[model samples]
Target: MKKVLLLGANGQLGSDIKKVFKEDIELICLTRKNFDIAQDEISKLNKYSNIDYIVNTTSYHKTDECEDFPDKSFKVNSSFVYQLAKYSNENDITLFHISTDYVFDGMANEPYKEEDTPNPLNIYGLSKYSGEIAIQNYTKKFFIFRVSSLFGESGASGKGGNFVETMINLAKKDVPLSIISNQYMSPTHTLDIAKAIHYFIKNEIQDFGIFHCCNTGNCSWYEFTAKIFELTEINYPISKTTYEEYKTKALRPKYSVLCNSKINKYYKMPHWEIALKEYTNIKHRKI
Candidate 1:
């Protein structure tokens, strides 16, 4: 079995990836507790020899928090990724990195493709895009999966909980939801993402660069919330508001939905509605 070094193993995506790789690959999991990507040196990786691949899900992804701590965001999202890419290049290890669809400025009327030039409006997006470029520069054996709006069984470590869980909790409390209606994105399940990555590893697919790994179709945050409420059988009040009406510290793209162009050639992605329904059924015990 091929050996894989999985970083950010405690994160929602990383956690599921571990589940997917169980008893299949020779895996070495590391969370931020064991190896801090920002502070810990990549030279330490020299201890884990014969690492065929390094799946890095480590990211400082709290968009609002990134605005206040640009240094931390860049260090975790860009600088450390650069170091990892360099290390992977020297060690002949294929690197798999997770990225966000927020790299786009969100002005596009249609879904953004992998080849679409990135024009980041916030520090977090800029840092992630920088990391993408670094990987492209330093490594040939790399897969940069640009995913969006992830929700999973394990709530995001960085954000405490995912939008789906938060919406359900708020609805259960009879709290009125004021969700953004204008910002469109592909709200993907972390399990599907893990499955997609596993497909690549299992098949040994080498067609690498940047691939948009998101659920098919798109919806606004309000629409996403409504679906969650529908699935969870919560008939709560939800008001739609634009991103400007509900102001945020970080600027979000009005349409940051990604088109899975290259990845479609490898694996077919389920629609957002289907993925969400499955997730709710299996995890939340409702659909």
Candidate 2:
């Protein structure tokens, strides 16, 4: 079995990846406390000379927090990525990096393809986009998977709470909630993403490039929350609002629906909606 090193193993996607790949591969999951990327992490990782693949899911994901900590964000998101890319290239090990859909400005009327030019509007997006560029320029053997609006069981309690959990919490208080309706993108389940990554690794399809990995269908944040309420039997008052009205410190993409045609053509996975329903059913014990 090939040895795979996973960074940010406590995060949503990293946890999902651990669940899926633990039995299949020799896995090394690293937490921030164990291995911080800000310090001499690349040098430390180089000590693991036998690792076959390095999957980095660690990111500074606080969209608003990035505004105040742009330097920290770049240090983790961009500079660390460069270090990993350089190390991976020298070591001849495959690198799998997770990126965000926020790299786009959301000005396009259609879903973003792998070949589209990125125009980020916020520091978070810019940092992620910088990482993407670093990977492209610094390494040739890397897989960059860009996804959007991720939600899963592991995400429910960490950092900023997930949308599903937040809605569930609000339901307990019987309070009305307002969600932005104008923003649109595929809300990908972390489990499905993990499965896709596993498929890529197992197949050994090493065509290194960027791929859009998200659910097949597109929906606004409001619609996604509404579905969550409906599925969980939560009788909370949820209202649809515009992004303009719910002004955030960070500017979110109005539309960032990623077309999964590339991934579909290369690797076969279940449809995103089907995967989402499966996630909800498994988590809540009902759909």
Candidate 3:
């Protein structure tokens, strides 16, 4: 079996990948305790001797919190990723890194293509974009999968609880919800992402480049939340709000919906809403 080293294994995406690929690969997941990417590169290289692939799911995901902790965000998102890319290049290991859709400025009316130039508005996007640059400069065999609005069984906590869960909880408490209607994205399922990565690995695609990996369709945050309430049979009163209403330190893009044309042509996954229905039905015993 091929050996794979997964950084940030406890994270939502990492955990889902772990659950899916544990039996097929010799999986080694490292958290902050086992291996700190912020440490020196020499030490990081020494810890993992012979790994075939390194999937880095670790990220400073708190977009709002990043304003207060820019240094820490850069360390994990940029500097550490640079070191990992260097190591992967030197060791001839395929490096797969997860990136957010925040890298784009969200000014485009259409979905962002892989060739689009990134003009990140905030520290988090800058750091992630920096990481992407590092990989491009350092490694020959690297895959940068950019996704957005991820919600999964494992990512509930990271994403401020799953969209469905939060809506259900709020509904049960009889609280009215206000979601942003202006901000748009194709909400991705982590399970589908894992399967897509696995598909690429199985086919041994050596063409290392950036790929957009998200569900088929797109919707605004308000529309997405409404869908969650609809699917869960929760009649929570949801009010439409603009991005301006939900002010945060980070400047989110007005529209960060990624185009699936490339991934669909190469490695297609299911539609966003369909995947959500499947996940909710499986987990909540309803479709």
TM-score of each: 0.98, 0.96, 0.95
Best by lDDT: 1
- Residue 113's lDDT in candidate 3: 93
Alpha-carbon RMSD, each predicted model: 0.9, 1.4, 1.6
Candidate 2 segments whose C-alpha is farther than 4 A from its true place: 156-158
* lDDT-best of 2 and 3: 2
lDDT string, candidate 3, 134-192, tens digits: 99999999999999888777654356666667777888998878889888898998888
**Model 2 poorest ten-residue lDDT run:** 156-165
lDDT minimum window of 10 residues, candidate 1? 42-51
Error of 2 at 271 (Å): 3.8
Candidate 1 per-residue lDDT, tens place, 1-287, comes to 88899999999999899889998888899987889898889887888758888899999999998999999999999999999999999989899999999899999999898889999999999999999999999999999999999998998996878999999888878887799988899999999899999889879888978999999999999999999989888888899888878878999888999998678778899999999998899777965
Report residue 19 deviation for candidate 2 (angstroms).
Answer: 1.0
lDDT comparing candidate 3 with the true structure: 0.85
* Top candidate when judged by TM-score against the true structure: 1
- TM-score of decoy 1: 0.98
